[model samples]
Target chain A: MKVASGLLAFVLMFSSQAYARQTFEVDLQLEARVYTENALQSEQKDASLSLAVTPEWYRDWQGGAHSITVTPFARVDSADDERTHGDIRELHWQGVLGQWEILVGISRVFWGRTELLHLVDTINQDDALENLDGEDKLGQPMLRINYVADNGSSTRLFVLPYFRERAFPGEEGRLRPPLPVDDNDPLYQSGAEEKHVDWALRHQGWVGALDYGVAWFSGNQRDPKLVPGSVVPVMTPVGPRLQVQSLRPFYGLMDQFSVDAQYTAGDWLFKLEALWRDEFNSVATALNPAIERRDDYSAASLGFERTFYGVSGNASDIGVLAEYLWDERGDEGSGFQNDLFVGARWAANDVAGTALLAGVVVDLEEYSQFYSVEFSRRIGSASKLSVEARAFHDVPPEDRSFFLVRRDGYLQLEYNLYF
Target chain B: MNHPRRKINVLAAILLSLVAGTSLAQYDGLSAEDKGLAIAREADRRDLGWGDSSATMNMVLRNRQGDESVREMRNKALEVADDGDKSLIIFDEPRDVRGTALLTFSHRVGDDDQWLYLPALKRVKRIASSNKSGPFMGSEFAYEDISSQEVEKYTYRYLRDETLNGQDCFVIERDPVDEDSGYSRQIVWMDKAEYRVQKVEYYDRKDSHLKTLTFHDYQQYLNKHWRAQRLEMVNHQTMKSTTLTFADYTFANGFDDREFNQSGLARMR
Candidate 1:
């Protein structure tokens, strides 16, 4: 409550200042989803509707040398009660001082240069409830400083004070596991829990056609391990039985070093993202009684995109993308231990700005596959309409990662309005 | 004692040759192409030494049906010594693409380097520079149309002189040296007094008249550089048009490599 009042006062002060240049905007979206098959869980719905809004306020002073931005987001969902939520996406003040730049407050930062997976991007936790693409992120409270160089290089240091746990879909939501995740009962390896301080440093530079960055982060890991929670008695047709009703989120402490680079040559762009992670502690799993200690592992995602311009003598262009994903721990570490992704993007380059992207990720060892397609076009100057679909095929029940989502194929449509 | 007379004689010879060289530098004994190249060189030379500049632009696009849309942007440019030039353009309007910036580093002999900064994603993506012929923002202006036009990109031929807008002009035809260019040749009308381009007629790859560009509201900056405040481009094939109106043109802003770098694109306002 005090923080809210303080933010209000800060906004009022900026608004009252005559020298400040203020701007405000809002984005509203209406989304609907329809499933192809019946949900595995009884409480989940076949179709769902949602409405989301994001409003932003910006004030710039001293000729853009200093500025403040406030963006808040809220959503109401019809199917899942837990999916209906609100968050402060961004509330930050940025300033420039000689050769240095400073930013304070909550902000969202993105890193990495790959298309399929971002192995090096770990600054903010994923907003899992929103989408499965992993592009959406929650705002992180941080203090960042950047030192800019003349040769297209930058060194940035981040000091994050709080950790935001990733949110999961509720029991009534689709595209989730059979048992819902118990977000309320979370376990952490860090004694400080959510108050743990995280720090990251990254230096990025470019040489001719190559752009590269090396980053190091030490703190709590963003992705959590799912463990079966306490058993609860549930009434059956004949009698009552004890069953694990939910999955508890377990976060561990870790140190990670990552390297990302992109090379641009004519119409081809080559991208690579690799990371090495060292966990400080390990815990026991529900299925395995013995405590398992995790060893240090390496992961990498390499890809390339080649674009063909002026196709058929029109303004349209098409690009082909391919990427390979690998992890040292194989299936035990990540779902994409040994996977290959191939995709294509078509840009109409018309007045309405129509575009389409379709991709498929195939697990090399398990033979499981995930296919996705997305198409979007501008409705007018301030509105856009998009359609997205995803499906899973040829997944074995023993596959630890994709079996739960094998029957969760969905088609979604979204309309966005900006004002 | 005799060295003083010899020195005086040598000095006289040097001064006489300097006066004679100025008179010999005219178009009397030159070919049509050589004269055209000389004029282009003079125009490029006169526009130098500004160091850096910044401007705000309002681009209005209209289609055959008369539907219109406006795009607002800010641009900053730095002059390089031997290379083409560095420029940064930040979009402001259309709400959707607000805060998006494009950084360009052009060269005289090769493809330019371009990066696009997506504000929502906070990601800077290196784009394929092969889209030089595609329309910019769905407007009549292609990507190459707005890029820095270096003298070495075209081969010139001097045509007959004519009067455009009641000003004496030198007409010239230039063929693009780049094979990927959408146009085969362009006929330009540059005023004789200031060497400023007044009008241009673009010919498509098939040597057909494709578009016409006209400039208006000439303004003088730094008492030497001439800038056109309004530029109108009309596509003859599609009957579509785009008009660019520049305002608040500031020169010598002290901008360095920092503002034009790809890493700084996301931080641009």
Candidate 2:
């Protein structure tokens, strides 16, 4: 928190400089969601409303060779207090010197080619409360140095000094497990905990139609293991005694190597994202003796996308996408282990910029299915409207992840105003 | 991405056709197609030696009701020695799309390579450049209409010579060779003095008149290249129009290939 405030002060100092070319803007979003069924958890709600505001300020000097951007975001939710939060989406100063570029402060970086899963994009911690799609990320503090070659190849080195813990839905939040997670008490394998410094290196280049990147990261794992923290006995109408336990997040240090590539051929794009990780004390062994330690794991996602232009002689395009996801841990891995994802995207290509995307992910072993649809269009010059729906089906009771959200189907609507 | 440079090239071709004073009678006995090819070659030759250029553009799109929306962007181009030009475009307006950019590596032949950088996601995505007929950003200008026009992409024929808008012009008809092109053919009017294209009429696949584009306010840069400051494209069928206003045209900037690559796109200001 001190670092965040210090960066804010630095950005303010730069923006106050009269000679700097500065611009300010804000985005306000109103969102509402309705569930199709009642939540299985006692504190969950069937409907919720949220409002988010993000303000951005940017200043550039030295003829754009040096610049700084500051964007801070805050949200308020009616249903879940945990969902209401604040974050610095971006607050960074960037400098370009001939073939070299340097960035300092907090920022977000995405590194992946596949659509179904982003195994290689691990720079920022996931802001899960903002969205379930894993697209929203919290800004990470770092010092980044990048070098570019004449051939368009680039190598980036990152020194991350702090780690941001991933946010989860609260007890009153929808799409959460039966027991709410207690984030205040998190366990870490490293004594330095969240203060452990992380490092990452990536080199990316393109050859003909193919673009590829390889990266190495040493840091605390982004995804956390939920272990039973405390149990309390409660009185029930049908039973004399029942025990309920809340989950605690556990972070472990790990080294990950990842590679991603995309090959473009006409209207078809083939993409691949693969990663291998060696973990130390992957789980809280002292807390959960029944769980076996996972020392190493490998995961991969491969996909292809094909777009058909002017479908049916109209100014619209339809793209079909398919991918296969695999994890060496199989059923023990995330819900995406051994899954197939098929999706379709449609764009109207009109002044309104209308678009629709729909997809389904099916587990190969348990036959559990998750379906999603998203449609968005520009409302006017400075506003947009979006609608989204998600549903789960045939979720096996034995599946630990999907089973939690089996009855949490929902429809969401969002309106954004930009100025 | 390089639409500004492409637009300049379109105007440059027109200026060259008028500047080069080649004798027309040299091809008196040749077929109309050969004469047209000769004229195109002369225009291409006269437009060389530009090296590199950059410009800013303000695009206005108007619907049939006359409601208008504006878009602003910056473009930088590097003239490749043996191949087509490589260029980059950065969007600055509509506020929401600020910092979005595109990079293009056009080829004299075959498909061009293009990439789009989305700043919000911090991702660079390679997009298919095969949508030559699709509207660019919902504007009346199609992708093919704004891309760098290589002479080899079309077959030309000299139709006739006439006076248009107080200037003597040579009118020509060109048919696209790509089977997937949205146009059946295009008719161009090039001024006799500067060879700058004053107007273009497009025919759809059904041979129906679709759109007409007119250039205005021609200016000479470096005393060698002619650029149209304003280009208006009107879709005859939809009664909609798009106008592109260019400004701050700078040439001979000595841009290297590194400046036109994907890395430069993300850092475009």
Candidate 3:
């Protein structure tokens, strides 16, 4: 919290400079969703309202060489208490000197090539409360330096001094763990706990027809292990209620090396991402593992995407995407091992930006399947409407991955107005 | 004249005449194709040395029902001595599309390289060459139409000289060299005086009329080159049209090759 305040002060100091030119804008978004089922059976409501306001201030000085951006965001959710939160999304000062550049403060960084899973993207912790797709993230505090070579390749080094815990849905919220998690009690292998200074080095460039990124990270893993802490039995009005206790998030230190690449030739795109970790837990082990041990794992995913332009002689495109995933841990792996993911994206090249995407990820181990379909289109200049449906089938009762929420599927209709 | 100076002038004149004679003889072939090739070569040679340029552009799209939308952007280009050219475009309007940028490296023969930077995701997307035929941002213009058209990308033939709008112009038909191009051929009208393209008619793969583009308001820049102030394209198949208005043209911006690299795209603003 002190670091966040200090960064806020620094942003204010730069913006207050009389010689600097400052610009500010407010990004207001109001979204309402009508779900097909009750939210965790906690209420008689089938609708949820979410509002997010992000105010951004940018101060550019020293001509085109120096600039600072500060964006703070807050979101309120009426249905789920854990989804309501406030955060400083980004507060960074960037400067360029010759062929070198530097950035300091909290920032969001993304690195990946595929859509199914981001194997090489581990910079920031996932904001799970925002969505189940793992597409959103919280800003991370870092000091980064980038160097450019004459050949167009770039090298980046990031030094992270703090770690932020991931957010989870409340007990009353849908698609949550069986019991509520206590965010306050966290255990770490490092003596410094959350203060452990983590760092990463990355190099990005093109190799002939392939654009590639290779990175190595040494830090406390972002994903946490739920260790049972304390249990309390209470008497309820209906009966004696017995519930599990608070869970401590355990952060294990590990080193990960990853590489992601894409090669586009004519109408086809070839994508691949592979990584090796010192030690990490998949959803199975991290949740209900009979064995109390884990080992280093290696995983890789390869995919290809191709599109048929002007399909049926109309101004539309349909893209076919298929990928195969492999994990050395096999069935004891991340549940994505030996699985196949195939999807299609339909695009209507019009003013409305109409599009539909549907995909299914099939587990080869147990043949359980999860599929989703999403359709979205712009309603106006600053508004959009979308519908998404997700379902599961043939999921075994003892499958650690899907046993918890095997029946928790819903369809959602959302409308968002942006300002 | 002094004996040494006179001797030197005589030698220089002889050498200059010999070079000029050889250049003339090189085009002495009787075939009409040779003459057409020479004319195209000379047309391309005239616009060789403008180092760099920057321009602000506004694109207006109108549908058959007369519904209209607008997109505003800025473009920067750098000339390359070899290979093709490198250019960048930054979109500034439509609120949602602001800060979006595109960087393209056009090749003289094969497929060109392109990348788009999306600000919302903070990621750079590598666009496939097959998308070259698709409409640009849902406009009437295709990706290839908006790109920097290099002289070598097409094979040209001199059709005839005609008068259009009371101005003498050369009519030329050019076929795309790339087999994967969406355009079968393009017929262009170029002014005789300036060698600047005035109009073009495009044909699709089926050899049917596709779109027509007319350049308007040509003005001289740097006292040597001509810049079109506006370009309007009409799509005959869809009954849609788009107009691109160019303003604030500046030349010789001292842009170096290092600035056109892909890694520098996001930092351009």
Clashing pairs in 1: none
Alpha carbon lDDT at A254, candidate 2: 89
Worst 10 residues of 3 chain B by lDDT: B21-30
Q: lDDT per residue, candidate 3, B1-269, as tens digits? A: 46998899879767985765323334455355555566566666767788899899898989999898777888989888876788989886554566688888888878888878876656776778667677776788888898778778888777887898878987888888887778999998887767788899999999999999999999888887788999999999989999999999999877766667665677555
How much is the lDDT of residue A333 in candidate 3? 51
Winner on TM-score (1 vs 3) = 1
Candidate 2: regions farther than 4 A off: A1-21, A232-244, A282-292, B1-30, B252-254
| Per-model TM-score versus the true fold | 0.92, 0.91, 0.88
- The CAPRI quality class of candidate 1 comes to medium
What's the lDDT for candidate 2? 0.87
Instruction: Please provide, for model 1 over B79-189, each residue's C-alpha lDDT reduced to its tens digit, 9 standing for 90 to 100.
Output: 999989999999987667788999999998788989999987789988878778888887888898899989998899899889998999989999888887889999999
Worst ten-residue run, lDDT, model 1 chain B? B19-28
- Predicted candidate 1 versus true structure: per-residue lDDT over A42-147, tens digit per residue: 8889998999999999888755567889999999999999889888889999987766889999999989999888788999998888888888889999999999
Error of 2 at A230 (Å): 2.0
In order, what is each prediction's RMSD in angstroms?
A: 4.7, 7.3, 5.7
Ranking by lDDT: 1, 2, 3
lDDT of 3 by residue, A1-419 (tens): 99999999867755565536666766676666555544434532456688878787777764346788898988998877888988887899888777788999998887878878776788888887777776678889999998978777789999999998887777556666566777767767677878999999999877556888999999988877776655566788998765456566778787999999999898888999999988643332233344244468899989998988878867788999998888887765566778889999999977777899999988887788888899988764566777888777788754555655565566776665545
Where does the lowest 10-residue lDDT sum fall in candidate 2 chain B?
A: B17-26
